[model samples]
Target: MPSLIRPVLATGSLNRAPQPTLPADGGLVLRPWRAEDAPAVHEAYQDPLLHQWHGRSSGCEQEAAGWIARWRASWETERGAQWAVADGGTDELLGRVALRQVLLGDGVAEVAYWTVARARGRGVAVRATTALTRWALEDVGFHRLELMHSTANRASCRVATKAGFAPEGTRRSALLHPDGWHDMHLHARVRGD
Candidate 1:
């Protein structure tokens, strides 16, 4: 007969509470999405510029709710983090910035973001993206971060450049947009760079 010996457990809390949310930066805060954000998200999607740039149309409330639910789940699981950029004063959703495609083993990740049409040319995307990049590299311990933009999106390219991402190269026919197969410009920022 084999004897079973159970290991003793530590006399302390086995499960700790979840970490607090990311702190606000400057006058803008980037935090997890909420159910209430669906309306703003839906409206942002309705912008013609977003549809043209992102190749997708606006969703109904139900659809937006589902999207928000997925985002909340991802946040809880630590698989990814998506922020609803808001004005610190008014707390209105300006857009979203996400750190996704997390390769934990390789310590790498990718960034994606958009600002409402009304927020464009005001440095909203730039500020939000820069804040997210700093958080990913410093707080999340990501070694490499990359952003890919369609060759035709010169505005996005400018954002990447302004955010201190170096132009890595181009991926030929890397994305199939609404127009057709398009070349993608890759930009990257490495840790300590």
Candidate 2:
């Protein structure tokens, strides 16, 4: 008869590593959101177009605090990851870009982003999304990245296209928007490796 011992895994090895803070070009940075960002985030959420496009509600101070709290918990739990896009020089919150719904077992992740109204048309979303995708593929070791947008959101679709994501396909009634159930155009980028 032989006695067997089970192998023990290290605690850190069982957990997802924390994402690194990285800077993008044009004085833009994507880093973890600070508590002080709540006010600006709340204000950005108030934009009707953002709410309509992203399904985010207009938030008060308390709600913004709660949002930040959720973001913190998500990082701790490894369920998702969010970052606040800011001006590198002034540190002002410009918008948000998230690599969320990370399927660790599958080595895949989905990206979502929003830009403040004033920040639109400046290539902010493209730059932020590109930087995040690079981080995910190169640093985080993610094999695949996915992005989706409502077909009606031509601007967002353009951003996805410009970010080097290829159009995969469209899913009918994939998302429930303010108007109704909408079709979503799916895009994907795979790591060269």
Candidate 3:
């Protein structure tokens, strides 16, 4: 029988998407995605790890470009933010880290990421995720950030752990995949955690 009402809002500085260049150890950079990255994105989607966990593929350069366009649109609409993790030395596309399911009013969001085959086993996902998490908590002012992964995706679980998202147990059959249902592990980092 608790109350369900809430206070009214003000026009805060949370509407616009933040553009930041986050640098990590060992020469990795997280920046906004670009249309010219379409080819690299299309190629990265060919990795079996991405297919196994994400269940979707860009398939072609045009579709990849379309994906980038959608990410850009989300920024303008203040719905989501996607970043391309690149090598600082060469500026080549290494992977992608994104904050999706953004609920600005509630100060909650979800993080997801994938690295190309060449970028695997190099801490690229972990570094990029850590940088994104810092920005989300400090600069973006979200109170809670979540990282969810299929139970079978051990690599992603490690990345989440390294990024300081503590495991909060699994949700039974929470995600549907190409093969069948997947139990997803819910990991999160709160503002004061």
Best by TM-score: 3
lDDT of 1 by residue, 35-148 (tens): 988888888889988887789876697787788888777655556667888888898888888877765556667888999888889888888889988877876567799999
lDDT of 2 by residue, 37-153 (tens): 888888998899987888877548779978987886677766677889888888878788987887665677799999988899999999999999988787667789999999999
The C-alpha TM-scores of every prediction are 0.87, 0.90, 0.91
Q: How well does candidate 1 match the true structure, expressed as C-alpha RMSD?
A: 6.9
Q: List the lowest-lDDT window of 10 residues for candidate 1.
A: 6-15
- Return the TM-score for candidate 2, rounded to 2 decimals: 0.90
lDDT of 3 by residue, 6-61 (tens): 32211243444356678877899987888999999999888777888889887789
Candidate number of the best lDDT? 3
RMSD (Cα, Å) for all candidates, in order, is 6.9, 4.6, 2.7
* lDDT for predicted candidate 3 compared with the true structure: 0.85
Clashing pairs in 3: none
* After superposition, candidate 1 runs with Cα above 4 Å error: 1-26
